[model samples]
Target: MKWRTLENTAKIFPATSGKKDERVFRFACVLKEGIRAELLQEALNKTLEEFPMFLCVLRKGLFWNYLEESKLRPIVREEYRTPCSAIYVRDQKNLLFEVTYYKTRINFETYHALTDGTGALNFLKMLVYQYLMLAYPEYVKGPVSKLGITSSTEEDMVEDGFSKYYGSGEIKEEIPRFKSYQFPYHRREHGRMKLIEGLVSSEKLLQKAREHNTTVTVLLTSVYLCAIAKDMSIRQKKKPVSLMIPVNLRNIFPSDSMRNFFGWIDIGYDFATRSNELEDVIAYTSDFFKRELTLKRIGARMDNLIQFEKNPLIRIVPLELKYIFMQLGAKFISVGENTAVFSNIGKINLPDDCESYLDYFEFYTTTPTMELCMCTFQEHMTLSFTSAFVTNRVEENFFSILKELNLDVRMIVSGDSRAGQEHFPDLSKETATHDFWYRLFTFSCLAVMVISNILNYLLIPEMFWSRYVMGGMASAWIITSVGYRKRRNLLKNAVWQLVLIGIGLYLWDYATGFYGWSLNIGLPCLILSCLAAITAIIIFFRLNSADYMIYMMITCLAGFLPLILNIAGIVQFKALAVICAGISFLTLAALCLFQWPAVKNELIKKFHV
Candidate 1:
């Protein structure tokens, strides 16, 4: 398989993304009519031809992660799961982007490692254009012909713009080290997000920006900072309300690459030292944008970023260790300094011919804190805020500021775009039922334990059998917990159960008496049974060798422990131990002979450091 290196900016995503922040973004184009799934698939097929780089999958290397060409293809489906849900599995070969539709909206969601918002918007535009042409050929012959739209060459689409524009210069990057204030509100359930999309008139927002003598981004960022300040206490106000604004590098560096070609600047306003007036905030934001958004400053930042990636010692570090350091950098350094993210995807322009067929464009990204994404189409600008917090106090305060300015702000709640309902599934009913049953079962368990202790005190008065019952319940809880946590990977769950059950059985034997039965008979039997069961599972499921080899090796190593114990004179019985040892040795030797390459690679990845 052919592979390519990831850009410097793209390397951090895999390490930092989790259930809370998926590092995924969505671009949706709502048309006047409902979306036809078949026609949308056809359009996606045509669009993928022009953007082949998006077809690759992220892979692990010795020292870094890379993208490898994948044979898997994307298919358009009706939107079922939440938007911006995880698309990249660590070792799975799946597409980095997905096209899903709901009602009249055509949603294009992409993993940040594949492309940034600007690059994804280009792909969505092409897809919408193609779908329109296929759906209405007559309109294409009329209005579409008047506009000129052509696909860029594939070579340009896959170009690494960072490498192309990186200059050999001394880096003098300075980042403020002060900690920013984070929202104290509790987060929603995992994989659940609250989206507050404010649709307003572009003309009115522009006029307001003009009155402030600032650009729309600076003005809106000012409003966002002020909104966050509304909920801050006097003590919290000491920290600055900082916003990380992403800038399109293609505009300044001149590249047609669809890969990640963007940079960000941090702008903040300290309410403690400066005036809290809106005008003051706008002026501060505008001044910071001017100073930090220049070509020289951005290039220096980019050079600094690239220099770290190019370091000899850093390059030699294993990918697994790199993930730890990068994850720490993202948590303490990247996330610690920013209060929120405000990404301006800027204005989205479609052909005038097809503009009437579209309602507007919407953009939003998953974030660990609050993020305000702005996109304009025709006369409408969609300001989308996706937050991890359960409360929308900051988002509500944001629109309240806009409403105070006399700007028309309407909530986009039509069709499936309603907050908490559009992206997340309605699980309240099911959750209620599950919670009721759980509570009932827990109460029953407590009642049973109390009854057993009372009966033991009345009848036996000295046996204390209830203690063994408590031990049994504890063992069952541990086993069930492992099963629930590792449900996604049955092989891993089986391995855990095998190890945990062995320990539990030995402890039970020790409590009964210091007998050698657990070591000589019970443990050997459990290991033998686990080996047989896992082998049958692999055959039945046709699992990949890479997925099960490590677990199998672990079980085989455990199988030898029984014979070792017998040889140490700890086991009175020896027949079962000898059988387990012989089978384990054969199993291990067969794995080395048949699946040597996978075993070798797995070992290297685990112990590379």
Candidate 2:
């Protein structure tokens, strides 16, 4: 019954734009009269305190670990931290966060490695709406003050508590991850324009889409492709329009978990002919994309992931050694890593009651390097836009074109005279600093996991046994507390895991003959761990075991391998035993910590659905 926290053992791939490890994009909106930071912050504090998973930070050590959900976890709290001082809020605002409050003007930049534009922007809109509604509950049902923007999606109330579309069964599908190389993609065109956000009446938006014979996805993507074609002056390239689309995995997976659950789905096309109107482009783009995205393709990708993770060698590598392999693995799975990714989270589902309180919302996209990051989120009618560019001119050029198309939109540049300028300069510097920190952080963590694995070999026999008891005891926290997450509740299960771990560690410590431990104790540890993992997985995940056990086993062996190698001089370290113990802590203890929950209703609704 012991379980570890879900924070440790989780590896968050840093966001990247080209080779850079960090980049952020932000957009801002002024609220209707009467909304202030204090009111919004209080609302967010209450909401997030109820959902603690949103507060986690990256845990620093040798291996990848997440912070325990703690008081310091992020909230509507403003960190007057030097440079970009702002509030950090959660779930009710984004795909990642439903919403939280920020200054009237905000930059929504996050490392591209964390998630694509589609997820980030949805987060922004939700955050803004949540802030306004919480602060001004009486604004209800209309545009407010000088902004002329009205409550579009849900500027009003609380979530319906769960998805209205639940139980439709129309949502499930399989996605292939871990598979070997698919066709590597190449950009079809060259020129690039910043993605522009515009407001269109819901009726007009739909009508325009109908006339063009395209869904919003195809229309926007086609616009992007055209911009690229123009920029690169891509003449005579065969049918060359392509985009990386992020597919949400919630519908694919049986669980209704509202956490980070999604996969990348690719959509691309070559033109039948070059001469085409916007309408023609839309029709061609729409029709081509429909059949290409299917459940079969997703399942194939999932199979690919299994192939990679289940490989005996991969499974055997310890947590410390995963980086070397992961880097190699990442390159193998990419599809023209340069072809721009366009993610559309579509319209966010806001609370119906929220209209009485909120202002409109915005979605923004960012990356270290890309022709553009196109993101869109719909409130009742208009889609707010947040775009990133290699240069300012690109962004300005995009706006010019949209105006030519007669689309009415407002532009709020970061350093405008609007007084919110206080937030930008600092945020910019912070973004730059983070760019360096994130990459170094990843590389450092990998190095630590590797070193810790090496240290496990030089341990004292008695000390080794004690450490395993301590680590196992620490690891059993969540498995027991899940039913009643409290310190006292965890004590019972922690005791059991501790005893079992102590016995397992002791058996291997002195099995008499050197090979005897492998045959007797090591073998049993291997067997029991496998059984324990598999049964829990099947019972919990409700799907075929997805090579998780294989990896866990591999991590343990990998941790041990350094010590064996050090003895043979393949590696050299004085504390090989200590490093080996570290591996046990990371593999068993760290991973257990990762098995906690992110969403409340996801569990409730999942069981009912």
Top candidate, metric lDDT:
1
**Model 2 over residues 1-609: C-alpha lDDT tens digits?**
111122100233421122222233343343445446576565456544333344433222223322222334333433233211122221111212222334543334443323334334444444555555565567533122222112222211111112322232222344322221122223112112133344544445556566666666676666655544444433434435555666664455543232334555554444435544555566666765665455555544544443444466654554446655555555554534434556555554444544444344444443323433333323433333322333333345444554555655554333221124432233323334534654564465556555544555455533444444434433343233332322322222333343445455545455534443443334334434543554465567453212143334344544554455456654434354445545555655544455423122222222221
In model 1, the clashing pairs are none
Residue-level lDDT tens digits of model 1 in 1-609: 445678879989999888888899999999999899999999999877767778888866678777767667899998866678888876556789999998889999999999988789988998999899988888754333232333457777778888888873337767444478878898876557677787999999999999988989888999999999999999999898888888899878877888899988777788989988999999888888888877888888788888788888998998889999998888767666888889999988877778889999989988888899999999999999998887878988999999999998888742222235543445344332534654565566667778888999999987999988778877876787677666666777788888999999999999999676778789999999999988988999887775578789989999999889988899868899999989999999999999898888766544432
Q: For candidate 2, give the lDDT.
A: 0.41
Off by over 4 Å in 1: 1-24, 45-75, 81-98, 110-115, 138-172, 182-192, 201-213, 230-236, 247-263, 294-336, 349-353, 388-397, 400-407, 414-451, 557-578, 595-609
**Regions of candidate 2 where Cα sits further than 4 Å from its true position:** 1-19, 23-30, 59-68, 75-102, 105-134, 137-202, 234-239, 251-254, 271-280, 328-338, 371-389, 392-405, 414-609
Best by TM-score: 1
Candidate 2 structure, TM-score to reference? 0.52
lDDT of 1 at 507: 97
Number of backbone clashes in candidate 1: 0
